[model samples]
Target: MKKYFTQLSYLLDSQAKKTIPLLILSFLFSSVLDVIGVGLIGVFLGLLTNPHFFLQKFPDLAFLLQGLSEKKIIGLFGVLIIVAFAVKAILTLLIQAKVIFFCQLLLVRLKNRMMIAYQYAPYTYHLQRNSSYLISRIQDNIGSFIGNVFLPLLNLISSGFIAISILSLLAILHPFITLFLVSMFFSVGLVFDLFVKQKLSSMGKIVSLSNGEMIKTIHHSLHGLTEIRVLGREDYFLQWLSKISHRYAHAAGILVALQQIPRYLIENMIAIFIIGLTLGGIAAGFSISGVVAMVGMFAAAGARLLPTVTQIMSAINQIRGYLYQTQLVYEELVELESITKGSKKIKSLYQKFDKLTFSTIFLSNVNYQYPHTDYSALKNVNITLHKGQSIGLVGPSGAGKSTLVNVILGFLEPESGQLLIDGKPIDNLREWLNNFAYIPQIIFLLDDTLRRNIALGIDDHEIDEDRITKVIQMAQLTEVVQQLPEGVDTLLGENGVRLSGGQRQRVALARAFYHERDVIIMDEATSSLDHETEQEVINTIKTLKGNKTLIVIAHRLSTVENCDILLRLEKGRITKVGSFADVVGISS
Candidate 1:
């Protein structure tokens, strides 16, 4: 229980920390009300069975009943009982509604906070993690944390308070008998929990694991649909998902059954215990009225007490069954918080600067090694790039062309190097990166209007129409936009599935143009275009040669032959650097 509470603390933010204590205090008030309602019912039963007993027991109020007939007294007590019960019911409902609303609100806030952390986390953090796992952590795991762990924990606490309150009232009435009954109930409950605790915990872990696997399987199968269909292996992915689904269903079913099974057993035990109590009372030679009143009071207490005990046990079982999710989500929350701790300050610093103003960027003695690798991806690499120079990189596959680009883009940091802007070290990488527009080999598009995709992060009202039109023409996407039914308003489908390869490339180029950055980096951006289109785009790029700093990586010789400077890289080192003809060993 202590460990679970610790894990819960890790999941809560400052607001939740404050809200939880207030909620628990409310639970305490609710439990007091439960005791009051039950105590009133006991007094009501005592009067119904033996009016003289109440007159003798609560003698201070005996004068009020002197003029009243028995029926009138019973009728008045009945009204009091109804009112007590009604108040308890109303308060319970209000408390429950508050609990549900708090859990839901916390769920939303936690999910949003986690997403923001992921967005601001270092690029290396994303490279090491799987997208499917991260997605499930956000969508599925946090929900399980709330429903299975936090809600059940709250129920356990609330039920526990009510059970103790009811038990205390019963003890005040019949001390020895209540003590024996509580001992018996607690002994039975303890034995049952010991029997099922390990099994329930194991099943919970299995459920968490299976949920993540199922999500990963589905993510992979959907993302690789074309490959699966081409390979004629639909059953392969289906079988994988089927196996995980079966495991998840089986574990989840067991947890549900185990949590509820205790209620039935505990209910029967309470019934048997009450019967024995009545038999024992009769054996003590009490008069009929006395025994009836005693039994009535005990029965009323039992009625309220039994359900609370059962609820407490059920809540314990649920917490045990979902313990793994609690721990998993706790760890995730802690890790995300630590990773994004400095992100806010960094983001603020990034916002302090506008467009970067620099004539040169120099990589001084840069060195980078990939995680868990013996070899450096960029070893003693040095390069200088001037603004308004069209530079090209030509390299073979796996020759570190992309790594160098990533380093230059500030996605990867060198072990020992300084990225200098205008001959001074750049202290703020985020601001520096914001001044560049990057186009990668692969394009990712949102399922939104083409216009929104082009101006991806801009608000609708803030988008400049004239600038959009100009970029559309510059990227050679004017014809494509006109061909669409709604022009730029047409939906692009998921990841631009509706567009052809060249058209997608054109859209990417259009997006870059819309950003209007001082530096444009294209990593094989025109590889998807046909010969004529590629040449036309290259010519468009040539037009920006003297205006914007352009860095282009291409395998095709003709692609960079007209550049102001060309570089050839091999095995993480720059092998050649000159104008195209000088580097290629051919006269211009």
Candidate 2:
């Protein structure tokens, strides 16, 4: 129980100061209304026992009751009761509304922070986590925390105040009966709490894990649809989905049983206790009115305790589960480190190289290992490219080709070694990156107009229409655009699925070309294009020979045959470096 409250504290930390006041106000109002109602009941009973009870108690109070008969007195008491109820209702609504509103605000803030953290988190964080789990935490768990945990807590506090008022009234009327009822109530609550506390918590964990698994199964099935269809594994996927569904259903059943059975048992016990107490009170020579008031007090107290006890238990379970999920998201956000200002400012592969020289682009004893990998992807690799030089990087698969690109792009840091650009350490040349652009093998495009996708949200003033057109022509995409109904304005489907693979590659190339940076790094950019189209793009790149430095990665030997220099890498080390012809002869 202490642990549960500790966890609740952390969950409420975001809104604690703001919500506490409203909660307290609501509870106070509820207690006041309940006490006033009980006092009214006692007064009405006293008037029944003696018509002039109010008059005898205080003469001034009696004068205020002049011209009012018994019915009118009862009616007046009813009005007071209604007023008290109205005040309690209004206060309760206001506090609950504030709490729920503040909870929503806190949830939105937390989600936004998580999103921002995701952007800055290291690549390994993404690799280690599942998208479905993250999505479930945001979409489902936060809502559960507010509705199941916070709302129930609000209800529990309000009910507790009512219970205390009722118990106090009972004490004045019949102390022994009040004590007996209180003892019975607590005893039953304790037994129920002990019986289902662990079960509720365990059920909550099962439900949460099952929900994540169900989401994962659905996500995987949809994302791997093509693979599933191609392999004729629809039934297999369905079976897997069914297993998750079954687990969720089983856990839900247990949760419902745990929630309902204890409440039913406790309610039955309260009913029996009420019946026994009523008989005993009459036997003890209590007057008819006193007995009625006692029964009324018992019923009112039960009304408060039953719902409060049930809701509190369920809220505990819900809060525990939600806190775990929230902790996952919070931990993820807290762990992410923002990219340094220097990294973002480094030149892209397409930057200009007027003063860039061979010695300017040098990596000394570079070493890098991928996350969770035993061996280094790039080890002690060294190379240099001069300005205006066209260099081709050739290597087998997993030969550190992509890792090399990632390093230069500042997406990954080397375990050891220094990368330099323009005769300065790469970190110092943050602003120097404006002169380069990169075209990766797999291109991504928004589901928007071809022109907008290529321009990538650049303002019209910054857009170079002529340069864009030139690149389109060079990449052989002009014909494709012309063939479309909207030409350059035509919308590309999601991930550019509307375009052929080669066209997608060309669009990426066009974006790089439009940038017109001093250096262009093509990481297998032309692999998807036909031999002829690839040649045309290469020739177009050569046209800018004196203006830019070009570094190309190609699997096709013919593609790099005429390069100024070629570097062959193997096992994270550069093994051969020379002109294209010289390296090819040595490789052969």
Candidate 3:
């Protein structure tokens, strides 16, 4: 419980923290009103059973009732009881509504905060985690934490307050009876909870784990649909999905059953206890009015107490069941927030020059190893990139070409050695990255209009239309756009599923062109295009030969034939660096 409260505290901001006290105070006030309401019903019962008994118990109020007949007094007390209950009901509704609204508002804020943390987190953090896991945390686990864990925790507290209030009133009316009922219910609830505690926790873990696996399976299947179809593995994925979904369903169903079972059993037990109490009171030869009043008070309090106890028990179990989800969300947000703060500190060192004044980037003896890996992805890599020069990188599979590019892109920091800008070490990674634009081998397109995809992340009103048009022509996308129903405004669908592979490459190129950074890195950017379109894109690259720095990684030798410098990489080290003739043993 302390751990979960700590998690909540980490997630809530100052305003939210302040509101908690107010909510607690409101709940306390509502509990007081509950006690008063139940007490009024007890008085009404006593007056109805025997009005003179009420007068005898309260001699001070006997004078106020001297002129009134018993019926009129009973009617007046009934009316007062109705009014009190109505007022209490309205106040309770308002308080609960406020709590729900607060919960929803906190949900939105939590999501927004998580997104911001993700955006600013170190790139290595993303590399260390799976997309599906991260997506599930943000989309699934967070919601579960809020709804199942946090909200239920609040309900548990509210129910506790109400139970205490009702129990206190009953104790004042009949000490022995209230004590017996309280001890019986408490013992039953505690034993039942302790008995099933571990099982509930285990089931919760199964459900949480199953949720992640199911999401991962679905994501992989959908994203790899083309490969799956070509390989005829649809049934394989379907079976896998079914297996995981069944586990999830089974675990979740068990959690619901466990929460509900105690309610019926406890309710039956309460009924038997109440019947026994009434019978025993009569056998004890208690006065008629006294017995009636005692029975009446117990019934009224039991009516409220039973549900409150049930809520408390269910909420406790619910919190236990979904405890894993709370831990996951808490750990993710805390780790991300820590990294985000570190990144912000790094970004704070940013010196915003009007533009990148440096004409060169130099990497000296750089090495990078992925987390938990013994071997380095890049080893003693030394390279120099001059502005306005085209460098082509050629390597076999597992040659660490992409790793080297990732290091240059600031996605991975070198374990040792330095990357320099204009002969000085890079002080700000963001500033260094600002001067480069990368076009990855795999294209990722948003499900938006062609224009928006090209000018990605820019708001519609902020997009420069003329620049978009110019880049579209430069990247050979003008023809494709013209063919669409909405031209540049045509929606591309997710990951550009509407467009062919070659067209997607062209869109990527257009995006790079639109950004117009000082340096452009293309990883097999034109591999999807046919010879004709490849030549067109290459010619476009040739046009920028002396204007923008270009780094191209390609498998095809012919693609780098016209480059000013060629590099051959093997096993995480640069094997050759020279003109095309020097590296390939042939003249261009």
Error of 3 at 561 (Å): 1.7
Instruction: Kindly list the per-residue Cα lDDT of model 1 for residues 1-588, writing each as its tens digit.
Output: 698778877778899999989999999999998888888777777787777757877889898888998889888889988898899899899999999999999999989977876776777888898888888888888898889878988988998899888888888888998899889888889899889999899999888888889889998899999999999998999999999999999998988888887788778888888788778878988777767776777777778877787888888888788778777777876776675565553454325566667888888888888888999888777889888899998888777888898888777878888667788876676677767888775677899999999998899999999988998998888999999999999999989888876687778778888887778887884445468655754875678788778888887868877788988888888889889998899997
lDDT of 3 by residue, 1-588 (tens): 587779888988887899988999999999999888888888899988888867877898788778998999999889988998899999999999999999889888888888777776777888788888877888888888888988898898888999998998788877888899989888888899888999999999999988889999999899899999999999998999999999999999999999997788678878988788889989999887788888888888878888888999899899999989889888988887776667653454334443456877888999989888899888899999888899999888778888888887777889998777789876666667778778776688999999999999899999999999999988877788889999998999988889976688788878888877878887874344467545644775687788788888877767777789988889889999999899988765
The list of candidate 3 runs beyond 4 A from truth reads 63-66, 344-356, 525-533
Ranking by TM-score: 3, 1, 2
Which parts of model 2 are misplaced by more than 4 Å? 1-27, 34-63, 147-176, 337-359, 386-390, 422-438, 448-452, 455-476, 487-489, 510-520, 525-540, 543-550, 586-588
**Per-prediction tally of clashes:** 0, 20, 0
- Model 3: per-residue Cα lDDT at residue 445: 91
Best by lDDT: 3
Candidate 1: residue pairs that collide:
none
Q: How close to the true structure is residue 253 of candidate 3, measured as C-alpha lDDT?
A: 98
For model 1 the TM-score comes to 0.95
lDDT of 2 at 94: 75
lDDT of 3: 0.84
